[model samples]
Target: MRNSRRNFLQQLAVSAAAMPFLTFEQQAYTPVPHNRQGRVLRVALMGLGGYATRVAEAMQSCKRAKITGLISGTPAKIKEWQAKYNIPEKNCYNYETFDQVKDNPDIDAVYVITPNGLHHDQVIRIARAGKHVICEKPMAINAREGQEMVDACREAGVKLLVGYRMHFEPNTLEVIRMRSAGEFGKIMFFQGLSGFKIGDPTQWRLDKTLAGGGAMMDIGIYSINGSRYMVGEDPIWVTAQETKTDEVKFKAGVDETIQFQLGFPGGAVASCLSTYNMNYLDRFFMTGEKGFVEMQPSTGYGPIKGRTHQGALAQPHVMHQTLQMDGMAEIILDDSQPVVPVDGLEGLKDLKIIDAIYAACATGQRQKLSL
Candidate 1:
């Protein structure tokens, strides 16, 4: 029982996928429709970090969502966001007391953009407050925590989504649509390279306790999740090997680099690399009997360029977070499902795969995955 708006988006996606002959001008300028309708989702962001600032900036262009409130432990950051976003004093609260959001009529949801370790408790609390939740990727430290958040949201009767912005990217969706239509027959392989060099030794991401791990927790999950969607199947097994060039900086539990392999049930194989000691490593490639797709600078912020055997992908490039927020608004308000899911279950699957990857790294053996 899909909603009307969801059906519309699906048909629009099909239309776009079918028209491969469309000129660059026509495709590049095809912006997502504006939100002129009345019901904008009032959202309170629970983090005031660098990424949160980016989301706030991007929300200015969002049609169906708006920043209505702020939650942070630092009063300085809260005041700064309040003044900048025109948030009233009444709509701001510290981490110690955000549960009072239940009484606030303006906010319909809370977007949790905090660190890896804090997601489980924070999301449960926000759900208990009777608000839908949109959390950043790698939903929690592991699948167990992600499942708890999912169950809490289910019990509280609220929608739980993850910030998998790529799921809504026009070019990415075009590829997915093509795959679903069997343009690429009998999938054979996928390769994802996601990484960047580490600059700071003191950031929370370097702290195993706060981050739950290192490069894998922060950036590696991209390749793990990418392999699933590109192959259009969940992996059944994973074999991994870890490398740490700087023992002191990366710590014992934190990983500096990991190369992992995924085995899909459909006889597809994927090779992925995740690292914190490398640069120029963002790419995804997949091949089948009929066609192939390659994306360089694949998962970066903007203008995600790519080409398939069909030709270069000409889909419009909106800010990833902007499209994500607007699409999430539809999911919350209209109960519409997007072309690709960004729900809590999707996030949990990624976590389950991550858990297996880490286990493989530790045991130096193939770890089986059921997700």
Candidate 2:
């Protein structure tokens, strides 16, 4: 038994040492900028789905945030998550009863990770319950719904944040930093391709009533939101075209694929494609007058690899969700500003663009955007 334990420890040490590709020589010990002693943001996860599971697990590495409570419709899932996260029974609630969280002091905020259709109603109720809300992307089905959520939180005197995890990624931020510093001079064009051959026809994402739309609602919003932040300007106009190869599966109001274009105020144009019938399509490329950036596997879970005219982006990979939760913790608890805005207004802008895209597709004409 002693020998086996010693061998296991040695293997673990070897794996740890092999993780980082580059390492600095030990000299003066320097700590990263984090206040471990500060107040922790106790967040209640409102959904126990796959993404919520990922966020809850990643938050275990956060210094300033924790999963203090859980909200799920399934009692079995709540019980399972409670045992996994060491959550007290009082800190758990179902969708039908989460309004009681208003009296639960342990939960400072609730992250609504439910489906797109459920965000608007759930966020508004959480705000009225006197708790801050961190809603997942596409804040709502349309700009009108998104605005209502924003107004509800505002009237209730609470914060409403969007779950844009990419905003805090180290590599993505490094590219944005370069653009702000004039390294990528006068950006001219961007291309975002986000898609995957989806599975399961009975899933809610394939239902127009539940998902609000098709690929545009579920995956296309990435390019829509990514264009604004990458180009550093709100779009003035949008033109979109839709294609449906499997009408039987896609059904009415659910799109199979979409190709859209966004015209920025600075004359920068973005050409993007969102689909549910293709794979190996996750990529983003932006070119400026002086230099350019390219990223493949851009919006996936980890190791978003990319390069630019200068050289490869050198920022080491950190768990994107880990950085996102910690950054959100600072924003909620310490009022820290983010490099990229993740507020309800920011989310509303994306919804406005989405409305325009869908309109353009339906009318077969260019839609003018004011956001």
Candidate 3:
């Protein structure tokens, strides 16, 4: 009798599960609220560096997005990109002619993938051209410039989004969701490590005027952002220690590596290390009362691996930048919010934390976060 009862209960459970699948059409056909059926977003590439090349490739996969404009100082690069992307001469602009892009009706947005120090001026120029702006990470050389960029976009009535690729990545999003849903219970501590052995001391990345502070500004920002997203909270205070193994390689104005700690409101702590002197070791680990989640290669360019207390996620993969561009398109054209957080406010918060970390490093004292 017990065996028969168990069999009946199993069948009942299966039926219950099948009911949702059988009625899936009822849910599947629900129309999207934004009604962006035929709209297409036309984008402009403002820089032609390695990152810009990657960004251009990513835009190819966006259903409602296309690269319609090209802006480069080099005629060779402009001609090459125009030919490769099939962009017309009418949509291409050099630094001298870029000011005229405001009159060009073909472009709706301009992506600034230039060095960190160049972000402020380029963003302002793009905003003045009446186009939305998408800027690479660390938004600017400092928080003040970041604020100015935000203000310029607001004044121009065009949207501004920071290129935070992880926010649109599936594995990172999964970790964020798990944390938000309380799957990890009361969060206690987190750890993040982001590093890459930077070569070519003469590269733009080592130039203080072009790349800003150093490893912290370029790749260390990832550690700052990852802890914030995974913890799902703004930090209340920060403490940091800066180190430089090769003074000649790092130079005077740039940092080689930095180890930092952030204190959250509920006593949660995050310890992070950012270095340009080490081999690649991008990872994030979050521990809480109930369980924990870990991601290896957490902040690389693409194809982030994710696992949780539930299990490994299975889906056909895409480039992280491609997914981010697609999601940005949806947000711009379809009025859809990003599944992962990637808004101006989120970018500003990360900058605020970064400012505190810098202050702590310089003062050799714990800095209290203002926001």
C-alpha-based local distance difference test score of model 3: 0.79
TM-score of 2: 0.90
TM-score of each: 0.91, 0.90, 0.89
Model 3 segments beyond 4 Å from truth? 1-35, 313-315
Instruction: State model 2's lDDT.
Output: 0.85
List clashing residue pairs in candidate 2: none
lDDT of 1 by residue, 1-371 (tens): 12433454555556666776532112212224555457899999998999998899999999899999999999999888888999999999989999999999989999999999999999999999999999998899999999999999999999999999888787777777677667899899999999999998999999988898999999999898788777778889999999988999999889999999999888999999999999999999999999999998788996999999989988878898898999899888876656667899989999998898899988999998886
Candidate 1: the clashing residue pairs are: none
Better of 1 and 3 by lDDT: 1
Q: List the candidates ranked by lDDT, beginning with the highest.
A: 1, 2, 3
Where in model 2 is the C-alpha error above 4 Å?
1-33
Clashing pairs for predicted structure model 3, backbone only:
none
Could you report the Cα RMSD, in angstroms, for every candidate shown?
A: 6.0, 10.2, 8.1
TM-score of 3: 0.89
Candidate 2, residue 160: how far the Cα is off, in Å: 0.5
RMSD of 3: 8.1
> Tens digit of lDDT per residue, candidate 2, span 137-163?
889999999999999999999999999
